[model samples]
Target chain A: MSIRSLADDGATLVASGLTSLQRAHPDLVAISEEPAYVIRAGATPAKVALVSGGGSGHEPLHTGFVGMGMLDAAVPGAVFASPTAFDISTAIRAAHRDRGALLIVKNYTGDVLNFSIAAELAAEDGIATETVLVDDDVATDLQRVDGAGPSQPDSHRPGRRGTAAVIAVEKICGAAAEAGAGLAEVAALGRDVVHSSGTMALAFRACTHPGDDRPAFDLGDDEIEFGVGIHGERGVEVRPRAQAGELIAALTAPVQEGLGLGRGDAVIAIVNGLGAMTGLELSLAHHELDGYLGARGVTIARTLVGNYVTSLDMRGLSITLVRATDRFVELWDAPVRTPALTW
Target chain B: MSIRSLADDGATLVASGLTSLQRAHPDLVAISEEPAYVIRAGATPAKVALVSGGGSGHEPLHTGFVGMGMLDAAVPGAVFASPTAFDISTAIRAAHRDRGALLIVKNYTGDVLNFSIAAELAAEDGIATETVLVDDDVATDLQRVDGAGPSQPDSHRPGRRGTAAVIAVEKICGAAAEAGAGLAEVAALGRDVVHSSGTMALAFRACTHPGDDRPAFDLGDDEIEFGVGIHGERGVEVRPRAQAGELIAALTAPVQEGLGLGRGDAVIAIVNGLGAMTGLELSLAHHELDGYLGARGVTIARTLVGNYVTSLDMRGLSITLVRATDRFVELWDAPVRTPALTW
Candidate 1:
């Protein structure tokens, strides 16, 4: 079977999506013409500016999130590709106002290299910056080498791949910065969220890239790619199709174990769609996840179920669990007014 | 190719989705166990209560929309099926106060019959009620049938099918009722919204029913079903696939003419995802649509781009346009706190 995308041109897809986003949310965000960055529209009390960006396909990730109580600026690259170092540095300089800026980079090689280079460039431009690298996808934590914690860099291990846990990091750190936290404190808080979080995904059908006629990968009728990444990459292993409850358990177990969650542990859970997954499916998956976690005595303090971080039209979902502290729960409950997530 | 659903059982899909929805938004909605209806939670002043429901697949429609600024109660039936009159009546009694109630019924045979019956049953229980029947789908306005306006129920025709325009009716009417408007006024506003709105859809792929292995129908790779409905039904015609701009124009032109839109007309535009269409695709489609409307001298007063009303996993989107009035814009700008729509 041939697959197709509504946006036929990959080169123009991000531009069109960004323009439409700005048009729909004129009050919340504005687009810079050159190098293409989304900036928070309305002015507010100056604090540590929160900036983030990644590949274009996982929208609402860095763009739809540029608004009050979230990202101050977001730079989007081409589909499934990292933004240029120049784009990131420009956004950081544009958003920072003496309060310094914090860059939330997902732990992809391209994204990390570009964001780190941008930080150095921003420093040369007289702007101080801190980086919070998110590596919450437990799928990449293969082998789990000694001292290979969420923040530790291990050359032998590729380490964790960032997935939906970035939502928790952005939300919590955004709340902290909005509440007047300093740069160091906000970065520290973000790292804390990443440390307590873990995510894993599975896809029965991979996503077709814009302008492509076939999906990135294919699977058998009764099989699924477990522990998949966000860019339509094949998962770590193939598993036979199972019931929704079993699938939920399969994704949730590793995250629960990675976080060392047990009886009386509180968590903020996110049952996120990887594009084609419906709200009905995500909610049902959440029901299964909630039940499983309850049976294990892990209390859910808050929950989010939707297509927040998607991989084009990949037909799958990821579960992210953040072992919650009182501060985390309070920050998560704080008022947010972003285009994709607001309360 | 076979399409699979995350939820394997159609019988329990609605229940699982609702349980998960209530769990996620406990402060916003509560599930009534017996007949499985979702009702708004939290205390509020007595006002005309807004209630609406339909089949389960078009989610975030009646259920995800149940909150402070939308439906007071939402009764979900099985996928692609209507709730019984008993379920609707129970929900009405549970939600209505001394100010009476308003039932927002989408114009489907089963839904109209059930909601009308429930309205009568509520009357027998000594509660005053008014009903607003929404049928804004221009695709179903076939043959015109001599004086078949949106609200007119001609015996000779099936009448226009209700589509995403129900979101406008429920939202505007909900805001009106929340502001203490009487039932008659709320119902009138809903009907007015229906009269001004028009919607059209196209699908490259059909959705599979929960637990089904195959899709509702099949189509060639280069053809699309134009003017499709929310129940995964076939469209009015099969048309050759075109570029994004041309496809957007194909859907928008008719709705523009159907509403008699011309220079200086303002509208509230909704680019609603049927289900599996990605946010990137939807936004890019919106960009083309915005350019098309602007070239025609029509202005978009407000825009909503998301999957508020979906057809499970159909890979398509519907565009809805409601000619804007001062009151409509005011009400549209009114604060709404629903699970699917909040600002």
Candidate 2:
């Protein structure tokens, strides 16, 4: 249930928001009237079109990223709901050039199914397409057991859920594609990015649904959920809240271990807010994470700290670390002019 | 009380966070060792330097904006407290070249006094300096009488509290300075920006100080504070909470009236979050404001919708509308590469 929304108008809210964004950057972006994909108006068809989308709530993710140096088109559904195959197909058709289109899909059941079907539909229309799945959440790295000493193999769990690391993938892949990389090369770069990255999130409070009055889940005054998914899915564990340093330590340990980062390993760190966290709090958390990683001998080569990817009004944050090579660093620093991620 | 922060150490947290930011953009920014102003690393002495700063809690406002195309130096004090005259003086000395330094000071009492003294100190040191005062908050537009309507004129109150519109002033003035405008010209541009802009903010919830457990203020679940100041000050009035559209209408009316803008006037609309508000909610507010302005026959030339300026963890938003001319629009669109407020 929404504690701070104009109830019962989530879809209209999203569409109108996209309209204003397009109006703001008319030179770089446009919104198609039907099935409504925010397309890059000035995107040159020199390389493969990079298309990504999902639900509406995690804004500035796919839609805010559609511009010259980022996504070619972004397809949005109703809040937290997947875009239909028809909508995705329409976006692909509009964005497809002579090169091809690459679909960047998060590892969600609905998104995977719908985007795959859209890819098939595009292929039938003679527009070549490929999909790169991003499954970088280390919070769901292992499955939970009923009552034993908390030991379950990774294979026992469903695949890790995708989170903020998708932004890193899109950015690097966007740069690669903008430099005229072919569809296969862009796809491979995205895959490599996914393979080299890990993210973990924790929720301080649950987000209320747009039209609902009750929160998606309840939390005690002194409790926090660790390894929380972007949606209201229960985290791997809930515990009495710890200090910011302790929380960062717990969060970064899993990510560092998963990425196998050690002393002298250069990496890009993103401390992303999951909506409703203060910039001050996020910076404080970033401070703690920096010290923790530095103490462990990891070289923090680059950093992005903000509310880039969000879960509506959920009061939490996520951390993503991408191991950086010279090529990746160069690509990361390349100029991007998007509504959300820009430099 | 802080519901989400680790207790205490606000100053250390800020310092460490700034260190991480400096590490991220080594080529663009650095923090001075003694007084700790975030300074642009590669600033050339060819043009007048633009400098701004205030308190610490407002991340990215003064510091995050220190980079190539925005601020030459940003001096941060403790959270929600003003920087000392010495610190501002140090920043002025460091940033001043033969072209002089322009100080962009928000119109808080402490900030005004300290920055003014700093200007005097800089003059004593033979560095030509000018100050541009921004007082664009329309929420504090008129003085309050005892149980009466807002009949008192602007002079009767403690002047309008500066808020988010300062970003507009800084950006435009920074551009003007970068284009080799003299100190007087840059100062005039900033004053014009302030005179041509108005902002009003509302809060759904109050933020707690980092070292405190109690919130700065409190509101009932069904109420909101309108015309709130950025320093957790109580608003001009309290009202029953309304839907998103109604809230936007309430916030935008004062701003539109204060700016005296109507009918086909081009404007840059900034729907800024006061921390802890979701992008979904802010975008919704922007959508509503866009419709409201369009219905009034106003043309939105540019739009910036995000948590650019914040009030710690206060869950609310502010709307700033800058009446745009060709020059203002060009300056707004000028490339900026700051840690925050970049394009």
Candidate 3:
């Protein structure tokens, strides 16, 4: 089912792209043959080095985020695939100062297993490592049936999938770490950010995998996939497309309830484009969501609307709400220079 | 024909969204009843105030760019429509502070007329105003016949259409102005940036005008429009899509030749998404383009790959090559705190 890519060599293409990015910021970044990259200035400034990675498709996620006040290093795998434990361990060693290292991992089966293994390997090498798992996707909160083979499991919480909220987590933890917080404190701060945030996404169309002709999923002209996953997995519902207000309501209500946000609460509202959504569309969505929240008496203290986290070329969007504390807001506003999210 | 949007009130929605942005950086931005907004920090830091605006559909173009080291004020019209002379005059007055004001305008008939009129009005009010017109689109470099009716005749150069390269112009001029350059000096720098740059765009799909179900143009499932205009105008050619390398070569060759970029020349390669193209696709295009230019021995000194300038929801990419002077590179790397292009 290989479709076509601009380059038949996917890894080489990604490497070259990353090289171009590194060239853009020669003073701040460096790439390595370890199939990893490290943000140079971050190493000496922090007590705990933050390392994060997963697949390469999520550009600007783990990689674009490595900078002065972000992740110290990022180890990228193949598109939609997890990096090897050896590569992760090497990234840890490369980013490690005298202080310990902290791994920020998304909640995926392969990522969890590999990152965990990398932590163990790092520990054996005398580097103390801690991990903060981000599981903020509210869409996957549905119960799973148990003992139904690999196809289905009943009465089990499969755990929330981490989507765009990892960016918020990284920003807060990176700031805390840079401010000289230890590994345990940084990890605790990351956990607090995750617990206060929730995300929901929907896609108008499915994304095509590289070298694959068929889409990862399908939708009719009049239908949209609600609660869509970043990897193009089937959503919880496939419903006829609704108007903007209703759609915004549907997406935001669950997130509000999940975070227990209510009247007079301040929040950071992030309207994230999942790849191909236009800036106009994201802004319009933010407008609608802002109105919805306002009518519900919630105060949006901070807002970010952009394609921060995406699923290849899928035409969709995800909304993330993080309940803001004075500390979280301070960290969020701290300066960090990354390839994608800056200023 | 128009396609449905999330909000029926486009103006209201846009205002709300901008309000949310203002809330995000209350210290740096403010909205006014002047039917325009001004970036507060830029006003006091420089001599000549940089002002720009156009239609609303182009999100983050004029508005998102209003901040430190960029535009001082931005006045937006309705979607794809030019701002009125009155509003433009107001923006000029609001941004003016003993220093003159410079308007950065894209070369479209409506925009040129309106900005020119506003400059005249500002002059009447004892304000010195200058304009830098951007006309870098090579797609519109058609032979114009003299003495023909509005519809026909040839032999006159209609001039190139201005597109994404306006960003380069704004950034350089903004930096020059912020550094306390005189109005003429800033204007001259803008002219230099525009003269040394060119852009070409292609769209995989046409964006619908809001409120219409029909697309602006038609293309077969396997076809794409080459040399597309940002306002959803028909391109010069429509052909079945080729592989990534062939497509990228087609797009980059014209821009390279237009800029007269040769071997050993350093250039900034900007692969901008026209709204809905995914980051992966844009990166793939950049990879192919990097190879194409490398084969020609052109050194890509810096690379910016993102949806910076867009035609809303149009699934396309535009390649802009700016011949880099040492000054250009310095300004490009200069810190800008805009909602869109911040680094």
Candidate 4:
């Protein structure tokens, strides 16, 4: 018997996958490029409608918050591809049927360029469109780390890579929207989150398209890449794989350095799976996380341990630590529901 | 160039694993085989203590729920192996140090036998230990497919397995303990859950131990075993691998027919990973769950889509459906704070 490829968006896979997802979790609604969704505020007519999208793969970041709180509309791109410009603009228009729409764009070239052009076209059509780029990944040099041996922030120090920033932005911005914060507040928080965030990943092997069976590259049974991205992007280092403690240290060095966490400052840790890693493994990584942070005398006030954000089926973990001020912790606790995430 | 093992308690995996589990998720804790957990309820002495344990492999179930509105103590067995009578006895004695204790035991041979012996031992010391067995797998035949379909209960039915029963019992009994339900009520509900519940698993291949690189069994690249156990038991059927939908249908048929899930009845589906299955796979299976339930006319009111209960790095999935009533739904909604699970 031949193995049915798991990487696909054919009606069969989508339909079966949705059923399985729903069966496993009733709260999540697995939307596809089919029968798109649009969001708008109830009761009072809201002043702003926000639209964001890329693909069916990047889940909770875009669609998970498409309730009355976060997004007015989210245009899902094809799996690792971009959504059509028309789809983006149209979805924005639908969500903005009452309020003017704003586009929340990530810093990816394709997403930025496409959403930016779509924003312009939507603006021409009389809808207010503002595009914000979330270049939160320090892995790609998003932030200048403040390095003092995990003791101080240095603008000149090498920075950590980006991790778990989208979660903070979507969650905080979504809460702000629910509390009637203006577009300025939402966009500002989004910007602040990106500035403070960093992520880096290592793909043990590359994932091919749905119909493809063979993996892109093979590693020794005991090999792992470092500083990789979710889309099968090669890592900064392709050293042999080590234990979770070493892996967490490698991932956390940049984060702790970039943020310059000290003994008193509190932080939130997100040990995210790149889709392929098991939740058990995700749970298991927490061991490395607490030990590393505690040994350095860092305080972790709040943590989200699970696959809050996933990159298809990439086999890796990304650590995103946010400096937890009182306000950021409040924002993290604000509850919003979507298919990929919930309170 | 070294491998990690669970045996070395002082090793990095053990040190960080325990630290991470405790720090990030405080609800989870490792009690000495003695099960010494301090509980303070308001100002009054605790009235009843809930104690549960089996093996360490099932994370959130017995251990994660030890924080609040759940178990007061959870003694863990090694990896996929059973805890000794001493561990169970110590946990029970400690929990009963100031109050009576209730032990929620899954219907496994080692667990049942050991917990029973411990209960008897506890009784000798004037501490009462009530044991409830959860045996909910309806997909496998203790004998063969010739066994009863879902219609018959395990005692009468032929193929009874254990998978999703952990969640159902945890939900029901956790709520009962929260509501101050008596030992009788908690035990009764636990038994009811095992009686009403059913589970089946599929494995792509057998899992090797932590230090072993190869699987215990040899399977073709495309082959997967159906009706697999959590400890990598031999599957009842080893046919050519099929689509997730077809596999799900095969898994569900025994339970649906045995339980008689008519087109009009409501149910809850749990698509669990047998350790190594990826979230992408779970999400894809989740897609299939809705369609399958809808086709059978089984209204799925509640679904949990994750690796809530997993086998050790086993690449398989188990589908569990509880015959839903208003009560069961209410139980599921009841809030319980555990290390691995929460509402």
Name the top lDDT candidate: 1
Model 1 lDDT at residue A11 = 67
Task: Give per-residue CA lDDT, model 4, range B1-343, as digits (tens).
Answer: 1222222232232223334455565434443412322221223235466777766555445655665556777766666667788777877776663456777777677887888998888888888656767677754554444342255656874334456677777677767766777777777777787777788777775655555656556678667677777776676666675676787777778777777788899987787766555555666666666667789788877777666776654667788888888888888878755655655
TM-score of chain A of each: 0.95, 0.95, 0.93, 0.81
lDDT of 3 at B20: 56
Which digits, one per residue and each the tens of the lDDT, describe model 3 over residues A23-103? Answer: 656666788855555455433653699999987777767778888788888888877888889989999988998689989
Tell me what TM-score chain A of model 2 achieves. 0.95
lDDT for B110 (candidate 3): 88
Q: Order the numbered candidates by DockQ, best leading.
A: 1, 2, 3, 4
lDDT per residue for candidate 4 within A178-290, as digits (tens), equals 67667777677777766666665555544444555554455556677666665555555556656667777877887788778868777777777665454445656665666
Interface RMSD of 4: 5.1
Candidate 1 C-alpha lDDT tens digits along A32-84? 96888999887757899999999988876879998888899999999999999
* Fraction of real interface contacts that model 3 preserves: 0.45
- Best-matching candidate per TM-score: 1
- Candidate 2 deviation (Cα RMSD): 2.4
Which runs in model 2 stand beyond 4 Å of their true positions? A6-8, A143-157, B143-156
Model 2 accuracy (lDDT, Cα) = 0.83
DockQ of predictions, in order shown: 0.70, 0.54, 0.43, 0.28
Clashes of each: 0, 7, 19, 53
